[model samples]
Target: MIHSQVNPDAAEALRGLCIGLTRQALLAFTAIVAMPLAAEAADGPGTTSTTGKTIALSNSYNGNSFRQVMVKDWQNVTAQEIAAKTIKGATVVSANSSVTEQASQIQNMILQGYNGIAVLAASSSALNGVVKSACAQGITVVSFAGIVTASCAWQVNYDWSSYGKQEIEYIAKRLNGHGNILEIRGIAGDSTDKDISDGVHAAMTAYPGLKIVGTVYGQWTSTVAQKEVSGILPSLPQVDAVVTQGGDGYGAAIAFQNSNRKVPIIIMGNRQDELAWWKQEHDKNGYETFAISATPSISQISFWVTQQILAGKTVPKKVIVPLLRVDQTNLDAYLRTIPPGGVANPPYPKDLVVKIIDANTNHSAMPPVPPPAP
Candidate 1:
């Protein structure tokens, strides 16, 4: 969290991005308009009043990465608003990718008296129970990232189905519709893998010319993907273009390197942190990969989601942020566009999100009776 307290100094910096820095200020300031006494309390310890505030963030992450950075940014932004005297404090409680552990964490947060909770489900099915229990407590719950269901109170996510369609479309065009393609899936049970693959199959179903040579699951880790690719290459005939979920972009390049093949491989993925390596590797080896941000900078979404909830505004039950394609051509273009507060928001109200989701409801996608391929 860069600034737990709002810095008027931040105004100048935020103005440059034109992200409605003024509007955020205006609305926050307006909250204190009719009631001067509440406004007086804005300067006090600030925790005394929790009228329209206090959100407990329960995130699903195992390590530090873009997602982690984004969460940190969200914390900083929300804290700034609180310090700026916008609303009350929003407390954030984090948990790694364990379903049982995260569920326990949510229970703990509720016991601690948190009013609202933002969660990233470990597994779409596994976390449904957690969401329901949390909602039963009358707490607001928002789920995102690898989470793909519409069951949560609200879900802010990237359109993985669209992301998959676009990447496959790009590969299909590059190969002129006929080539051997390899797919490295993300975390096996995570909603991201299912939605993206669902979109890929939805698109590829029509493109019979493009043959899927070999399929494997990488669990969204570069090391696992590297090993999986090394194993997949020997059994396959040839790889024309490859599409993977995340760091597998680097892994695909490594796979191509291992085989010492001349055939071109295209990697479609997210994660701007890898840009430095991507540039250096491509420049040195002359063979490179490309990617599209599967999910928008997670940091920006957290703040936007938090703000929407706190402002007493109604937001969509589900918000799907789009991704930007990054090849060698425009990699630098998006470099500065990432991190917290990256993309701009669409035309929507502060509370539209609430109307779309009924906090009392519980929804789930029935597990495909047949288990997925491991």
Candidate 2:
């Protein structure tokens, strides 16, 4: 039986540190501000001299939103140790969001003879061949972001199915076991979305009275999610609450308010702005869309998990970090926690990019002023 939770180390650091700080959060800011250095440190200047283990990193996408932060976190941590000249030189290959590109990149990496591969899969199932081949060649394959098939060494990600189950259960509990729910899905067909959607389906089954009145595909965008919800609101029965797969209650609020629906909505998405808006909603009640957010702390967790693998520890096939539920009670701290980039990347010099990043030293004491890119 898949269990409910895990004991997370440094659990306190992740909470509120990146969500709602007025000034850049000392910790969150440290993580982002120092990320460049941390990553550089992980991938030292020289190659094949230290402990002598080659680790190849390939990412699915490094754009914006939740997934973007996740990818960068892995890169940053990897840089720290690599920069310190402890491990062998690390090579990062990417394909943005294209499965074919990722496959090609992996094939190339294998031909070049890397010891292990860390990949954030573009498509969970589509990457099976690459993963299988890597393992066949005596390479350790680890999937950090999405679901890679069993052929990989470890899955350091939140279980999507469980993400849905826990989030929906929380929503049901908030609504006193009965309410009209509007479902918004992330980019359709993505492994995370599918897992979360399935978990929501499973969780809602336990609460039969909780009727999911409307279902729409948000495609994981505020604008798209808003339009989708906007169209559904006019005719559907009044929704008592909402359970969406992506974060962005602002759009959901616009949709809910447009329908003249005034009920609590639960968004499974996490961003600093979510907490900021919730704080405003709690006080003024203007845009009172949602009070709580179920954030998975993917950025922080992914970074630490990769460190374990690089150090040659036995990583669980799947490490499902506990969900952080934030409401009015913790709104202030949460909002203050999200720094400029918070979990996402910030502008930095190309010279500093790497795989492992140490937060304490090897960083500027304060954020560096952007020296206008040449």
Candidate 3:
């Protein structure tokens, strides 16, 4: 048998190459392990994923159509996020315009370990203590529609004062700055009500001839508005026009009708029934007026804002959402989109919410409302 001679130098080279490859492989693996995982990356560098976060809504009131629509919007938006695995879960709890009850609800949410809570406040200041406590626990709080005064809570707000002023301005123009105006206010102690009433009273000073002959709190409910306005109509002179804080215009018109008085220029609050009544009157006699209100879809925006905060994005403490206005020019278009007994609720998808946040960050104007579908 012939024996083959082994090359010791070649053997040493092969062993060295094997060790080098092993070292390189280990280095690559370590680098990868040190990098951020896909699950933790979100929005941009330094941001964290919101996938594991859960959010909740603490609503103050569900008594009116606007509030009902707001709750429905929150459910629809949060449900979509949960189904997409963007958030772990979400829930909504509503109180009947009671500050104490709302505070209790928020306290429960905090104890339940929600990552975020969106509040439709019952009072501007009553819920501040609970809101601060949530913030101290590192939970994000977003207050919308009826905002709170907590410094740590983010607010998605509307220009309620502008809404009120617009109504009075339109009435003054329609009546040529001289009319007996009937004023319809909303919930008495609500921050929104106070803001709008202040704006209305402030704007009324510009036109000395325009006097507010009657005032009634409609509680932003049509039935309540109708009954209250009816009760006050007999004692007052003919009302030339009515300036309203939404959800009460159609009732004011009904009150006038029931009292056998002529219906004047009643500013609508963008409710479906109110729009329908306006359309009927418009068709019959070319009656014209304006409608404006904060869209209930602000709930959707609030949800996205919370999601962004959970994802480690820096958002402003106060984000202003524009009010929805329906004019005689596009009343029919808005009317067609609303349900039989619902408010005008536009959708607020995540992308639009991002734009709104970015705009607020840059101190620019928020995006304008899209025109109604044809």
State which candidate has the highest lDDT.
3
| Every candidate's lDDT | 0.62, 0.60, 0.86
Q: Among all windows of ten consecutive residues in candidate 2, which has the lowest summed lDDT?
A: 352-361
lDDT of 3 by residue, 104-200 (tens): 9999999999999999898889999999999999999999878899899998998778877888898888889998988899888777789999999
- lDDT score for candidate 2 against the true structure: 0.60
> Where is model 3 poorest over a 10-residue stretch in terms of lDDT?
37-46
For every model shown, what is its TM-score relative to the native structure? 0.67, 0.69, 0.81
Candidate ranking under lDDT, highest first, comes to: 3, 1, 2
True-structure RMSD for candidate 1: 16.3
lDDT of 1 by residue, 1-374 (tens): 22333346667556533445556666667876845655333321212234456776777674756566556656676677678765566666566678888888878877876677777767767777767877788777777665625364677676679777877888888778899888888888766698888988888977889988888898777778878988878888878887787766666667677888754666645554355556666777864556765443354454446555545444457655545456666655545444532321122222322222222112222111111122
Model 2, C-alpha of 240: deviation from truth (Å): 1.2
Tens-digit lDDT track of model 2 for 1-374: 01112224356444433333423455567888788765564543222233576777787776765655554554675576577755566767668789999999999989998877777788878989878988898777777656587645666554467667766777777778888888888787666678778888998888988988888888766678789988888878877776776554557766666767664565625555445555556677543333323332344444344444556443446554334444444445545556842421222222221212221124323222222222
Q: TM-score of predicted model 1?
A: 0.67
Q: Which predicted model would earn the best TM-score?
A: 3
